[model samples]
Target chain A: MPQLERLWNEFKDKGLHIFHVESQGTSEDDLKKFCRAKGMTFPQVMGQGSFSGYEGGSGIPYAFVIGADGKVIWQGREGYHAVITEEMAKVRFPGLGKGSVAKGLEKAAATFAQKNYGKAMADAQKKLEAEKGKSSADAAVVADAEHIIARATAVGERLQKKAENAKAEREYAIAMATYKILEDGFKGQPFGDNAATALDAMKADKEISKEVKALQQLDAMLAQLEKAAADEKKKNLKAFAEKFKGLKAAEKADQMAANL
Target chain B: MRRLGATVLSAAFLFAAPVLMAQADLKGKDAPDFKVGSTINEAQALSLDECRGDVVLIKYWGVN
Candidate 1:
């Protein structure tokens, strides 16, 4: 993480950004403490979904670099500092190896490719704002940034529609996943807010509430049964059998108890 | 001996249950978005969208 911080410092002016995502259910306070303890300064966000399948998702400390063209130029589980530096070097502006406005465009392209539409749009907007009423070269950069914003917004809307469709079909899990994509993938956008609203509505549904409770009960029962079966004491086994006597799993519980 | 064996088998099964839970494959795919408050700036909420247009390095970790 310190390596990443160094990299962020080195390339931030050249249009490099780092977003640290906290996985494994760590609280914000603990994450802050960790950052303070490590003297880290890059921006961080808490992960909303499982990090099981993202780039280098097989494990922790995964990274991916997106080119200004909105494509993933590099990704890996380690050595991101070296990998990103090399990739950024390749995208260096003409006669300007680092810290150039052109390089910002390249970074914006990469962000768009990564599907971080909101950030991509913002970056492009910033460039346009900074270059307003400047030279023709500046105008070109502004035009490019505008193009990125338009493209990113279109893609975001498409994703939002897909999430809405999933909700319409009553595919709660799929809808939730899609909404999550919009909520997280297109933050600060209308789609993101729409996704949040849909999710909140789902949480308020009585049927979903009942289903959640049933699943929780089932899970508790399974844990109890597993514990009772693993116990060597005959008294515990008999007690479990009696406790679950009216339940569907009671027969299996009894059989396991008898084996004890 | 039979009772002991049964207990050992059941214990093994119990331990394996969590491991059997599903793990999604997210590598080489577009990263998902999430929201978290920033430690550097108090009362500020941050999200993945904020890092757009730059090379984003995300580390998923815990304090252990």
Candidate 2:
């Protein structure tokens, strides 16, 4: 647990967001106290995690590393210290540690940090090409530029594949969400443009749009239900499941209602 | 009562956490949303949806 805390301290600003979820059915109050006692600063989610999709193995102390592209990249109970660090290193610009990026790549790095992969890559590469043999730090600057482009391209590709896979499986919600990430984060990049086109195409389909709306409705309702009483949640959830019948999110609503 | 009831229901899950964390098998799988009670240590609780373009480490822990 302390190790995870240390990891968070090391990379919190580098696109690493940690959520300390309470799965032992610990009350929110107790969860807060526990976190306080340990001086932990990451966000803590108090709930009985369904542990859905959990194939079951190492119980408790388990983890799931969802990448910047919204795909689960790594998961395990232990021995993942290196994996965690390595995964984080992928997101930090210049494909390096938490150090300040090279001076020549500052503007590009700022763009990348803003989640603009296409522009950042193009900017960095253009700068790299222009710097061919001008500076004494040619080798170092060239390396950073290449790393940024490669890493950005990799993230964009993975998200493209994930969105495609989700759409192919008719998981509209996941597909739409991923496509949005690509559209917003990739900019003029190839995969990012492809995702944007696909997203526009998806919105044009009546059936797909309906499915997406149903998902949005479910998410909005769930957000509302968070503050609601148990009895109220049960009642509302029943109505939602019946109304949004046949949708996965509605099925989830059913499960939540039953558990309530 | 709402909070207490949630605690009780979450406890029932004690006997049923997932098998093991399997990144290899679960890669690209849509992670199911877990029950959320409150935000601790942060101003707002983060849903998986809000984590796009960011790597989120969901550490499921327990304390009696």
Candidate 3:
């Protein structure tokens, strides 16, 4: 809050416009209360009603810095952060702090590739914090966070795949969660196009890829046995028999029955 | 009643506090409008629409 206040104070003379986008649910009341509390002298919209145009293709807190000709000088993070601010910083300031934030994030990504998670996270977090009214910092943080997770997960899956112990469904779930976070976080940014791309990849849920199908089949068989054991332990013998009979792998079913 | 009065007074002050500072000039274009609770001599809302005819200096002073 102090950071936000300082930003407003510092940039007031620079024709900086701050628009708060409101949506339905818990965040709605928060916006109203924030408006009242912040003494926002500028225009704010209720967002749900006639204020939709201000929302652009996305929703609230998504700011745009427009040039005098009505062209979007900066569109907030469609890929990673607030779209308008990101676009604006690159277009307007070019080589300002926002640019540095972008460069720092790129460097951090390189560092992460070298197995320096601590340094990467620190560098990314610092850039995110120092990123003033500029949207680049926000985009950098979002991208870096997702990049770190995605890279780490990919490496884990790669090692597991090489060892013939990969769990396809587990990989899918992790990827899905990563994409979901990115999707939610990029709401007001101009990075909508990139977000859509990432979302599509996540939604693919490629569990049946040829390289993973065997592992998935084995995992399914193991899971069935585990469930049977759990049911048996719970004294649900009838359910356990039903589950054991339903096993798709005949070998696993026979093995389980032989054990029983 | 006291709580209600305090709430109203606080809201009024919050609403008026920024206005007390020099507002950015809104000379032309649509003047933005904002509303607050009841206050003495306070317009029900502040709108750039009201300052339409003259040199409406609309100043944007805040984070972008």
lDDT of 2 by residue, A11-92 (tens): 7767777776677787776666667657688877666343455432455777777765557777777666677677775564
Who wins the lDDT comparison? 2
lDDT digits (tens) for residues A11-103 of candidate 3: 432323333333443343455445544544433433333322333332223343433222333434232123333433322221111212244
- Candidates 1 onward: DockQ, in order: 0.15, 0.26, 0.03
Model 2, stretches more than 4 Å misplaced? A1-14, A17-98, A133-137, A165-171, B1-64
lDDT of 2 at A13: 61
State which candidate, 2 or 3, has the greater DockQ: 2
Please give the lDDT score at residue A229 for candidate 1. 33
Model 3 vs. true fold: TM? 0.22
The C-alpha lDDT values of all candidates are 0.59, 0.70, 0.38
Per-residue CA lDDT of candidate 1, range B3-62, in tens? Answer: 999999999888765544433344445556645544342211144444444454556554
lDDT of candidate 1 over A139-193, digit per residue (tens): 5687677777776776566666666765665445556777787788678878778
Better of 1 and 3 by DockQ: 1
Model 3 CA deviation exceeding 4 Å by range: A1-4, A25-32, A35-43, A52-61, A78-260, B1-64
Better of 2 and 3 by TM-score: 2
Ordered from best to worst lDDT, the candidate numbers read: 2, 1, 3
